[model samples]
Target chain A: MTAFIGEFNCKLDEKGRLSIPSKLRAQFPEAVGNTLVVNRGFEKCLVLYTKEDWLDETAKLNAVDDFMSPDIRRFKRIFTNGANLVQIDGAQRILVPKKLLEYAELTAEVILVANGNKIELWDQAIYESELNVDAAEMSQLAQLFHQQRNQG
Target chain B: MTAFIGEFNCKLDEKGRLSIPSKLRAQFPEAVGNTLVVNRGFEKCLVLYTKEDWLDETAKLNAVDDFMSPDIRRFKRIFTNGANLVQIDGAQRILVPKKLLEYAELTAEVILVANGNKIELWDQAIYESELNVDAAEMSQLAQLFHQQRNQG
Candidate 1:
């Protein structure tokens, strides 16, 4: 598996549409996908997953034995309730559903980050803040990502 | 940061050079990254991180406070001890250090998997086995990743 890599700065137009950089879009492996699923990410950012990856993720979420487990339910609901099928148009742009745009607090400018399995869309300032880490704050970040990843 | 995506079937040449697929290479924002760090990943695979991502990963690993913590020590050692600075050649191939090849049990054939922050190099068969996840294994995977991440 080749991870999608690199970061790109982009914009959200007045209609909440985003133009995924062609540089980024061109890496899609047809076997894993060209289709995409947009949904809430672990953090405030929005996550975009290839359709194939989405199925793998959904399968994991589906493995939760207790459907009534609050963590499982909340996690599933947050993901599925907000999940939207999307595509980059001929112009290499994708329309961010109004709810998704709001979920990520995206304004005019945004940063599209490629994390291993998905893409995280963050408010530019927030994205910058997240990456500007220093040594002393290490432990704090450890706790932060831990809590965030487990927030369910 | 871009999460690496897609699975690629590749090989470790007699000289131990791994040719990163052109498709994946095309995703890099730069003509070629100035630096790369190859290290031991939590799984039985070798991880290749762009210098920028390695810095972020190091920041997280640096959070471990107790040198006496065996788990933390082992995790840190795996990453640091195996970490090697490498360059991708003009032909878009990287020389896999002999030690790393042995560490990941790479034979003539291998697979490069794109993970969010890094590329995982695995012996082809091992990679396939690792990916054959079943429902009962989901919780186990969740636990394994949690423990691995917390070790730092």
Candidate 2:
């Protein structure tokens, strides 16, 4: 498992294809082979995972004990059923399904991709507007990470 | 908004109550006054957000035009319907629904709270298994962020 961290901004072409950063692309060679799973992320972003990772994730979701709970049924319906397996073309691009593109508010224009353990794609304006990071808290964030690194 | 970034280890009692870090508590004054939303996050973690943020997020999901395609229906069912909103107690603790805890593979012992734009509560072992940083790709990730940050 590799840590996929950082942020990226790029264009989604007319056909809805966006390039995966080369570095990140290298991490998925095994499971992706050719196709990757792209799905809705928590915020206004898209999440991409290799086929194997997707299967592993969905298996867990499927293993939920009871479908009686609305949450479990809903989780199965949305996360599991709503996923799309797309292939990365020669240009390192994957076609963004129309529905997913709309969900993330991404157009053919600029898109922002943030690296978490998962990849999150967002519309440039919405990403900036929704991300409420404040300069005043920079030191606190830095300190927190510093402490974690020290503890680790 | 106060940035709550880092890792904090805490216990989720038998009753499903876990203490919120003081640093994170300071960032969600409104949530303290009312309720917050906790939902399933990617990477076997639970995501916590203020009511305002949750509403904003769900509204977007709700707006997905299900009439457009089968994918829309799937998205609506999973992302929107699976979500749960819980109120925080005076002690800054919220009950983790048994189902959600099970999804994240949490037990009575320890949980790891990680800071992203939102907080992710993860089982300690799962967090340890999932936390692998790729030092070899740091420069590439940095370059991507640099390019994106520099543009506009």
Candidate 3:
């Protein structure tokens, strides 16, 4: 499958609805229907997942021994709290829930980034600053990732 | 795109190459080109991502402050170390690398599971056991996920 790629800019309507950008629209299969799951993500970004992906993600959380530690329980609680099912209308738009919008600090201007398995919706300026990190830092990241794989 | 769904069993050749089942193959876009990334996944499964997805995943790693703490560093290391690129041959087969194959304990029979952004390769028997979690646990999981989202 073509991996979800590129960055998309979307305008959240006054009622908090935003159309799924064509870029992402192209990645979806027609048969999966129009359901989606939106949740609060790291930083000030929100995460969007096809419903199937949401269940898959929940399994990951299920595997985590949340009761093992207070930190893990807290993290899981916050993460799960943000998840909500949404429907993409005939025009391929979704109305971002108010609390979720607030959780991610979303505004009229938003940037959507495809992260392979999921999409990240970010406030425009926040997205830009995120991309502004030093190139050296980015380079180091690749190196670090490599170090882990090589050992395995 | 349709959230990739379905399970197909495959026979691993002596060389460890497995063909992409027609079911999952149907999910891929024809024009994206054939490169893919395979990596170790949680719970003894192998995760497959299109090369495009790999780059998207790198962005997630980039966001983590590598020097922030030992836990994140260790987690990232283990996660990243198992990643490797595999090219799909004209016949639509991918050769699992030795290290990755070992990581997932793959053998003669394998199960391919579609989990939205990625496809998981699992040992046939292992996959069944994973699906064997009690109904109550599964029910409770759905409840937990909703409990978190409901308050939001």
lDDT agreement of model 3 with the native: 0.75
**Candidate No. with top DockQ:** 1
lDDT tens digits, residue span A1-152, model 1? 33555456788899888998765786678674445899986567888888888888788778877557787788677667888988777777888899888878999989776645567788988765654445555555445545543543
Better DockQ candidate (1, 3): 1
Cα lDDT of model 3 by residue, A1-152, tens digit: 22354456689999999988764687777755888889987667788888887888788777989669998889778778889989989888998999988877888998776644677788888766654435566556546555654554
**TM-score of candidate 3 on Cα atoms, chains taken together:** 0.50
**Candidate 3: Cα lDDT at A147:** 61
Quality of candidate 3's docking, in CAPRI categories? incorrect
For model 2, how does the per-residue alpha-carbon lDDT over B22-60 read when each residue is reduced to its tens digit?
645665655347577788875577888776767776777
Better of 1 and 2 by lDDT: 1
**What is candidate 1's CA lDDT for residue A21?**
79
Which residues of candidate 3, in runs, are more than 4 Å off? A140-143, A146-152, B1-152
| Local accuracy of candidate 2 as per-residue lDDT tens digits, A1-152 | 33466677778888888987776677554645877667777566778766666666655544453223433433343344335667789988888777678878898555545454467777888877876778878778899999989975
Candidate 3's residue-wise lDDT over B107-138, tens digit each? 88999988777889999988899899898999
Query: What iRMS does model 2 reach?
Result: 17.9
Clashing pairs in 3: A1-B28, A27-B1, A28-B1, A28-B2, A29-B1, A29-B2, A81-B148, A148-B81, A149-B81
Error of 1 at B21 (Å): 23
TM per prediction: 0.49, 0.44, 0.50
List DockQ for all candidates: 0.03, 0.02, 0.02
